[model samples]
Target: MTDSRRSSISSIKSDVKSDIESPELPLDQKHFGNTLDQKAQAQSKEQPSEETPSTIPNGGLVAWLQVLSGFMCFMSAWGMVNGFGVFQDFYSSTLIPDVSNSDISWIGSIQAFLLCSATVFAGPIYDHGHPRLLVMFGSVLVVFGMMMTSLCSEYWQLMLAQGLCVGFGAGCLFLPSIAIIPSYFTTKKAVAMGIAASGSSFGGVIFPIIFRRLEPRIGFGWATRAIGFISLTSLLIPCFCIKARAFPKTRRKLLDFAAFKEPAYALFSLASFVGFVGLYVPFFYISTYAKDVSGLEDTLSFYMLPIMSAGSIAGRIIPGLVADKVGALNVLGVCNLCASILGFCWIAIHHTAGGLIVWALLYGALSGAFVSLQPTTVASIT
Candidate 1:
């Protein structure tokens, strides 16, 4: 009649059926079998499908705190990488002045490359229930890398410290930061991820400004150490606050070679590769371009990357809200197209400081949307 009564009756029927089908036994053994059945039923209720409404908190203090922790991860990891433009400018003109721009660019390139490539290993590790371990280890590497970069005076040293060390450390942080959000909130995944991803934009803006203002006064080494100290402080938040929810029984593999056989996976991978190749070109060289072509003052030239990064903060947030309604994949596609068009438009902005600023802001917004939506889209299809 009532719900509880019906459940009890159904459970009883399930036990009786099980006992009848199972091998005949004494009364004590039958009672033990029924107890085991009840325990199994309880376990099943506790571990419901991810899509089940009761399983996902969707909104709560704990869930939102996870978002905050993820935000910190984005800031310390990708944020530092995003600010490599400042380093690029410094390395080309001041630090190792003899190195060609192409050679100097490799430091940032390797850093970015490792940030993505390390995920192949990090993802499987995270799924194996070592999130806190990964975050802690990554935090150490990032702070350590920045500290090492501060002491470096040569190209090879810079590459090892800033490029390999920081990049690999960030790769460790990036996967767990993005992957854990889906476990807490299914309905709000896009918005939550957007908020978390905006940390990089904030980091992007803050790191460049810190470097720009402090580098001249304190010198590059101390300025970089200050950045490292800031990263250490910010990373502590994620290290403590993030709580990894246990996923369903599906096991994660280090590499799913069969994933490439699917058209969607193959196409998405290709698109991401192409998008990234063009994306950082503007971010890395915008300051140098402004100085050489528009003859802007060094102070004004250095601010270009910060301006672009500042613009991305909004782009990172607004698109997620939109994607929650329209779809992450659709929003990502549109943003990619817009970003590409703006990349071509860079050729025409060499004449005016005002033009370059406007272009940077617009491009930042579109590219930010693309970056924020990328993981959300992948989570959806997978």
Candidate 2:
């Protein structure tokens, strides 16, 4: 009986081992398949969640090309505005001799007003992928304005050409360059913008010298045509080069009133307005003031422009670097205060040559600070 029980137990153990080795147990098969599926699903989830790298190339041929394009655009547009002093002098002396300084001031004032005020509408339009059209239209208007201006023999005609047409054109051209910049670059944005903004200063330098030399040799018509040619050349590069990157597909509203919800923007706008009011007065009046009040020669007066512009070159660059460190608003506020003081000083020391020179130097330095700081200030607040 004992032998029979031992044999039975061995047989049962063998049967259990055979059952464990079989592949057709339904519960075990289901659990194994489920485990494999869970692992695969977890891996699939992780694969799609990986971050994408940026398309903005760091300091290569394409990057430099973008910088070059921006420089060209800015030089063509803002450069002309900086060269307004030459126009002011010529128009006041030749075309509208009867017009007072204040009366003639309207031309430049209107141009500046249109240039800035158009930002209200142009910003949204540019953000919407119409940059090429905007830039082309601006080029046409600027060129046409110059062409018409060369033919103008009257104050109103000049105003229409220089103030209305050129101003509007500049606004159109400038919006794209400014708007497209932030799209292409984030890390190198300041450097890129600085290089671009220098175009104005460069234009300021080149145009005055050109106007001074060419006004004597070629006369006003051909001199202007020369400037127009330079502008045309500079304007063309942006048409091909400036492009938006990963811009949103949705249409932005015509007016972004949402921008004003921030108190900082409102304050900046006010400060900018006040700063511009003081800023342009000197640029317009300095040559005349030097010629009439200080008894400087015409050539010397013209030379003052480039000198001030030279100061401005430093102004635009140095403050940009400082703004990154100390805060743009702090730098800008200090700049405005300095500009105001310098303006008062100019008014106070109108009769003395040394004082006037000091004022110019000081004012130019302050203006540079203001120019550099303003953009930084806007960026900071925005």
Candidate 3:
């Protein structure tokens, strides 16, 4: 069945040029033939006179602006998700002291889970060419959710506000930021995404510091609202900058259940899903865990999140640069193994300040690539 399906790719000798110039892809006869969209694009490039010239600019002033817009979008959405540790640690000690760690952890869990899973639905809508609307509605939901969060006093209230509202809002915004880039660039995809994905680490580093400073001066409610104001500004860029093609030549179905038929895609998707089960554990708990084990004052413990994020800034950018030269999957697979090793190390070293600090930095640096390269990994496969 696979050989029959791929008979056409073997006849297309022109693809060898791309294969030679680009980083190597994992081999399979059916995939080498190319997926439907890739085959269509290859044919167009091969026979431009018979088809319309592609208006999807690869790299230009406009393309770079979209990259900047995507960066800001990621900074606010995933950045806020990373900063959840500060809020989780604070709410447990001050706002909802009666709640169990497991219970408080769910707020961050739900937010992370929703933000990651949202791609399933959002991917199709972007294909439909409503990029601006998605960005606008997502902006509203994100800002409003943060504003509402300032007034919550109970666990359920916080969950609905931050976990449900903010999570979904971030999901809505996050998917578009990711989706719009491919509409603009191909050869530069790895670098463009790397720069945008770096925003999460930037946000992670900055927001924790923001919370640590403002929490005391303005109090908790206003401190959150202050973050909301920052998100409002960040969310605006993508709304105006990122755009869809004026005339979409093909429309894909919203969901492709048949994807389960392919072994590589199925297994990779499953691995990506399972990776998340443990993915955000440290991001959610590390700061509080550091305080409890090390007996540090509030001033010192909060810096741990920022430190982890600082290391992540390097992790996201450097691997992306290397992936373009080598292969994204090659980098992604190695990064995931390193991240898993760091996860095990998390279990043993909670007793000392230096140990906790060192572990957070190492783990953050390794894990950042895991977070950034997920989409690029899937892109390589399918």
Candidate 4:
């Protein structure tokens, strides 16, 4: 780089540096350096930098760390929530035996509902740059709620502790991880989400088996406490590492109900709402259904959720790469259709363990794909 060329580029300022990458000026003594300097000086005055900081370090150590934190966050939040089927099964038989099946199901239902919906509110807060505190607070509620669950024997007590407290904590902690992801990635957002969301798939695979193995050995209270301790450990990294980058100023409206004005967004929201209606149906009822109608033994019935979740591991992974190539909405549409078809087929698999296992595999993969792709699709749209 010649002195003249360097002087031309450096004189413009930080905004110019951000808006354009200055070319390496040649050191040729004759034509090249002087000509480039004249052009750079003229171009600098013509184009004004608009104060947009190009801070998206798309691939770097910090960015990968963000992805790592997101993985742990998803594991702790949605992955933890995915284990609710185990709790539902356990609670119905032991802690709250008198409670109606429908009533017991509500605990998991509400937890799943809150785990996703709270994101609507938490997202806005995250855009404002307070993820660490929000996560820490949520971690406390979740761990404390778990500790409290060990003492609760009544239906209402369990409802408030496990359903509300744990659910609320999970909900609050969930969005920041997902919401921060787009800030660091653009072209590979779907794949990053797939990897991060796979945490939940693993959670689903592990937590249920733990609950089943632990419950008989340690009883409900201590088993739940053990799970809580695990959650505490899973949450520590995300609580410290997840940070938002490149979001707009916080003065923007928190809840933009006006986004419904866009027909595409409105329909997308409706589709998501419709999807959620059935999303938890299988996870919440697998054990109960296996026990009640499939006539499976208690030990076998408990494995249904674990099997479904294991299938979901693939669901979370493969569709992401596919979405990256063909488009997120395309993959989501296909998976949602598969899920709908599998859901209808679910009615045919009664009293046969083989049939139930096949259904679990198909539905679990479809559901996992849907869950993993939805966030990427939302960000991709418009």
Locate the minimum summed-lDDT window of 10 residues in model 2: 45-54
Clashing pairs in 3: none
- Cα lDDT for residue 1, candidate 3: 58
Q: Write the per-residue lDDT of candidate 4 for residues 1-382, one digit (tens) a residue.
A: 9999888777777657765785544567547768889999986655433322265555577778777887777776777677889888878887788988889888777777778777778777766667887799889988898899888999888889888888888888877777777777766778888888888888888888887889889998888888888889988988778776655533346786777888888899898988888887898899889999889998888899999988998899899989989999999999999899988989888778999998998898999987788888887785
Q: Better model by lDDT, 1 or 4?
A: 1
Question: Each model's C-alpha lDDT?
Answer: 0.89, 0.74, 0.82, 0.82
Per-residue lDDT of candidate 2, residues 1-382 (tens digit): 6999999999999988988897465888899999999999996654433222365554566666766776787677777777677778877898678987778878888887777777678777776767888888888988888888778878898889988998888888777776666555555655566667777777777987887799779888888888888888888888787665544445579887876778989877777787677677777778888888878878887776666666666666666666666776787678778878777667678777667666776676667766544654677678
TM-scores for every predicted model: 0.88, 0.81, 0.83, 0.84
Candidate 4 Cα outliers beyond 4 Å, as residue runs? 1-55
lDDT of 3 by residue, 1-382 (tens): 5996577676565577677787576678558667877978986754423222365577898888888988888887889888889998988899999999899999989988888777677767776777778788878988999999999999999999999888887888888777767667766777788888889889998888888899889998999999899999888788888775442455568885777888889999888889889877888887887788767777778888888888888888788888878888999889889889888887677767788888888878878888777767777888
Higher-ranked by lDDT: 1 or 2: 1
- Candidate 3 yields a Cα-based lDDT of 0.82
Model 1: lDDT equals: 0.89
Best by lDDT: 1
**Model 1 lDDT per residue over 1-382, tens place:** 8999999999999999998898578999999989999999997866645556578889899999989988999998889877889999989998999999989999988998999999888877876778988898899999999999999999999999999999999998898888888788877989999999999999999999998899889999999999999989988988898788774466567785777888887888888988788678778898998998889998899899999999899899999999999999999989888888888888988888899999999998999987789988987776
